[model samples]
Target chain A: MKAVYKRELNSYLNNPMGYVFLGIFVLFFSVIFCYINLYSLVSSNISYTFSYMIYAMLVLMPLLTMRLMSEEKAQKTDQLLLTAPVKASSIILGKFFAAMTLVLLALVFTLPHIVILVIQGNPGFLVTLLAYIGFILYSSVYVSIGIFISSLTENQVISAVLTFAIFMGLLALEILFVPGIQSPTLYKILSGISFASRYSDFSMGVFNLTSLVYYASAAFLFLFFTVRVTEKRRWA
Target chain B: MIEISNLTKSFGKHKVLDNITFRVGEGEVLGFLGANGAGKSTTMNIITGYLSSNEGKVLINGINILEEPEKAKKLIGYLPEQPPLYLNMTVSEYLDFVYQLKGIKLNEKAEKGEKSEKQQHIEEICEMCGITGVYKRLIGNLSKGYRQRVGLAQALIGNPEVLILDEPTVGLDPVQIIEIRNLIRELGKKHTVILSSHILSEVSAICEKVIIIHNGRIAAASVTDKLIKEFQDSNRLRLTAEGDAQELVKTVSVIYGVDSVEIDETKTNSSAAEIIIRTSKDVRGPIMSRLVEKNIGVINFGLDTVSLEDIFLKYVGGESDEGSIQERAE
Candidate 1:
């Protein structure tokens, strides 16, 4: 796990893709930060920072996660990782944790906006912390989904395009569910499924355990599916 | 020791390895020979735990690969047809990472690991594979032979007991082929090395025992010398003589120690003929004397010996059967 983690992290940092992802993410965040905190007069709420992140992440998450498995498959490097003396779960988690760490680092860099809020106004840090947790959880879900989608194909372009489509569908699951469903019960269950619905409560200063469980477990499902997908390809 | 019993792999209904069985003793070099698409790589992949066999068992040093893959994989190191390298990394970077992947510790001792002796082993493998000069270079920049060595070096890390390499010498120049063969030979003294190749001479030169696979089944399995001996008579000769072909044939057929003779007039010049001699055992000396005494002046005589190529062709055929997967279920 340590070796996989170290190597993956190093590859990201050493390769140009790392810089591209970090730059795109930071650049977009800074633009939103200036608009939300500086240009606006009453800049007390740091939670608005997250609203900007969603739009950014719709583009940003795929950048980091699209190549996660697709590139490995393309390069035939997955053969090394899969054939090593490591369990399937360890491999899945190792990759998950490494990509999560990168996303966390980028999220951590968003701290300055919150620090300014605290310095200028006595804003609730709890709400801000909850919002940040929501950010990580939400991005992790996308990362796993992207990884799962990446595993389904060898071509990076196809992986990237299909991942975008799947993500758009996840983002719009609510709209698709309506008029088709006749029950309020089904509506609530699926409303609980979207990243926007699950994350909205957290961004509103509420950290719900149900939402937390939903995101974590969904991530696990994707990881599990990713393993099965990879294993299936070996036989195919 | 490596044992593969009743091993079979299939993609859907297509069987790639069909009930193949073989055993390699410790420190033995086993050469896997087949024509292209003969399922050599498929068998190797299953043994290395890279691909699961639809049915069968692979045991390395007494541990089953399927039941306990992690522990079993620890005992074996593999270099696939492609090196499975991260070309973005330097050779040292790739190996250090491989060493760590096998759970070899890099720093302070864990409860149990190979961290203490890790660097020396890495360096030693680097030297053994002749990649020391290119250790600092990115793997992508190295030549095909160097990339192959790096892959070999990765397989050698952590002192694995069994090494499975597929077409290990595929892209090498003649000199590099000899070097890699020598290295494999030297390693065979300590490790059970199993490699596959389509080149017959390479197998004849390196292997003690050879398994010839054709159409996903074992066509022949024997010691290399016996396979050659069965087909080639070492002291046999073919001669063209200035005489009636049938008369020459009748004379040579009666000679002592002459095993069998075939006379052909179609390929002969006027007043001459060609006769192929097969001694019951290697008896070229007696056969030649008898032929000369017949006064059928020997036009030309040349000794013939069956080569590995002939045996391989006879078994695998000139063009290997175009094999395919039947998409069998697991």
Candidate 2:
């Protein structure tokens, strides 16, 4: 697991991928941070930054996870991993955490926003901390979804596009439930399943255990599916 | 040691491996000979735990590969037809990754002795595979031969008891092919190696035991030389003499115990003619006297054995849609 993790992490860092992801993420994050906090002078609430970061992740996380499994399959390097002594689940988790680490690294680069908020204005530390936790958990669900999509195909472009499409649907789930589709029960059930809905509690300064469980279970569910897909592909 | 028993596999309706059974003992070099799409790669994949068979089991040293994959996989190293490599990584990094993937603790090995045993083992493998010079370079920049060496090095990293190399010399030039063949020969001294190739001479040169697969079934399996002798052509003798080609052919055609006679165009020219006599008996003395009595100047003569190419073509039946003997006749 460590071998896979280190190799995957190095692949991101050793190439332009890590830098490109970080650069684009920080640029977008700063633009949003400046427009919301500096320009609007709404420095009291930092949750807006966390909420926008989730949107940023809907695009960027796919980029990080798209090539994770698909590239390995295309290059036939999956043979090495599949035949290695490690369990298939461990390989999946190792790659999962490697992509998560990049997300964390990109988040780390956005740490200056917190510093600037702390220095320049009245910042809500507790809310900011909770929102950061919320952002990690929320982004993990998408990251897992991305990794799962990557495992479904050997084409990286297809993986990326499918992940983006699924994430767009999930991000728009709340709006999807807005109109009258004549199914209230279905709306309530789907709204409950909406990952974006569960995340709203965290950014609103409420640490609901149900929301936490929802996001955690969503991440676990996707990761479980990813492992199953990979295992099934070996037979295939 | 590896044993595959009644192994069967299929991709949906297309059966890839059909009730194949074979075994390789410790320190035995087994060669798998097959044409393209003959289930060679599929069988190797199943043995190495890369793919699961539909209705069979592969055992490595008596440990079932599917049931105890990690334990069995630890005992084997595999190199697929294409060398699986991360082009972005340097050779040292990729090898280190593979070494760790094999579950060898480098720190523990380092703690065991003065210097790092992990590094030492990797260096030794590099030296053996002749890739020491390219250890620091990225795999993408290296030539195909070096990439192949890196793949070989990856397989050699854990020093697994068995090595499964699928068409190890498929795309290499003649010189590179010979080099990899020598390396496999050297590796066979300590490891139980199973390699697949379409080239018959390669198998005859390096493998002690050869198994030929045709259309998802084992067409033949035996000692390499024994297989050669079993399907070998009829014995023949060739005599070069300074005589008329037609006269030489007609003279040898009437000899008793001689099956047939034909002028050896390869050896015949204006100054001399060569006639090959197919026979099951030793008529060398009679033939020599007959040539001398005819006043024909004899240059050289010798008996020829069947080449492995003939045996392979006979067994594989070439690409012709006919019986093996009919194909051989063609």
Candidate 3:
């Protein structure tokens, strides 16, 4: 596991895709940070930045996770991992952590925004910490989904496009809103599945345990599916 | 030691391996010879625990691969047909990844109690494989032969007891082919090596035993020399007579052991022509005496033994029936 993690992490750090992801992430984040805090000085909150960054994540997560498993398959390098003494679960988790580490690295670069807010308007550090934590959890779910999609195909473009389509559909659930349903039970279920609704509590300074658990569960479910998909491919 | 019993595998409805079974003893080099799409790689994949067999058990030194893959896989090092390399990594980094994947360092910490020793051991392997000079070069930049050596070095990591190589010398030059064959021979002294190749001479040159797979079935499996002997055509004797070749062949065909006779018109030297006689047993005494009785002076005489090329073509060309899969009765 340690070996796979180091190799995968180095691949990202030493390759061009890692810098591209960071560039796009930093550029969009700066644009959002400027519009929210610099252009509109009325708001001193940094959580608003986290809220808008989720939109940036929809684009960034696919780039981070698209090649994670698909490249291994396309290059036939998975034979090394699969035939090694290590289990399939370890390989999947190693890749998951490697990709998550890069996403967190990109998140760490956004710390200046919080520092600027703290210096000028004195935003509470605890609220900022909770919002960042919430954002990490939310991004992890998407990372898991992206990797899961990567395992289904050997083509990186197909993996990226599929991940983008799925994430966009999820994002649309929040942006476009669900069609009006006559039943309150169906309405509650639809709203319950909306990531935007759950993340709204964190952006509004309300620390919601249910939303945290829901995000964790979703991440676990996607990771589980990824492992299963990889294992099933052996038989295939 | 490896034992595969009644293995069967299928991709959907298409069977890739059908009841195939074979074994390699410890420290023996077993060569798998087959045509393209003849289930050689599929069998290797199943034995390496990379693919699951639909039916049967693969036991590695008594431990079942399917039941305990982690433990079984620890004993086997596999080099697939393509080498399975990461192009972005340097040769050293690639080997480090393989070493880690094999978990040899962790095992060394528990079993050997030394870190410097492991480094030295890895360096020695690189030197042995002749890749020490390219250690820092990226695998992508290396030539095909270097890439193959890197692949070999990766498989040598962890000092596995069994090495499974699929077409290990397929793309190498003649010099590299001989070098790799010599290396495989050297490795066979301490490891059980199962290599698959379509090259007949490569197998006959290195392998102690050979398995010929055809159409998802084991068409023939025996000691290399024994298979060659089994496929030997009827004993053939070539003799150049100083007299009429046609009269000598007619006289040789009358012998008790002789089955048929043919005169080589192209091999005539002056008036003497080469006569090829097919017989069931050694007919040299009878043919010589008969020639003496007929006053046909023999210029040269020799027994022609069957070459491995004949045996390989006989099996791979599907001329030998499937019933020949039964072990030869010495």
Top model by lDDT, which number? 3
Could you give the interface RMSD of candidate 1 in angstroms?
Answer: 1.4
Residues B44-133, model 3: lDDT tens digits: 999999899989999999999988989999999999988899999999999888988888853344345645666777888898888999
Candidate 1 or 3, higher TM-score? 3
Candidate 3 wrongly placed segments (more than 4 Å): B106-115, B239-257, B263-275, B285-301, B318-330
- Docking class for model 2 is high
Worst 10 residues of 2 chain B by lDDT: B321-330
| TM-scores for every candidate against the unseen true structure | 0.90, 0.93, 0.91
lDDT of 2: 0.86
> List-wise, what DockQ does each model earn?
0.76, 0.87, 0.86
User: Residue B48 in candidate 1 has what lDDT?
Assistant: 79
Task: Kindly give the number of clashing pairs for every candidate.
Answer: 8, 0, 0
What is the lDDT, from 0 to 100, of the residue B202 in candidate 3?
Answer: 92
Q: Tens-digit lDDT track for model 1 on B1-330?
A: 899999888777677889999999998888898877779989988897888887889898889987898998988889999999998899999998998889976453434554446667788999999999999999989998899889989999988889898999988999999999999988888889898998889988888888898878998888899988888666578888887887887887787777788865567766789878777665656667887776668878876667888888888666634432221222
Off by over 4 Å in 1: A175-182, A234-236, B106-116, B239-254, B263-274, B280-283, B290-303, B321-330
Superior candidate under lDDT, 1 versus 2: 2
Model 3: residue A33 alpha-carbon error in angstroms: 0.2
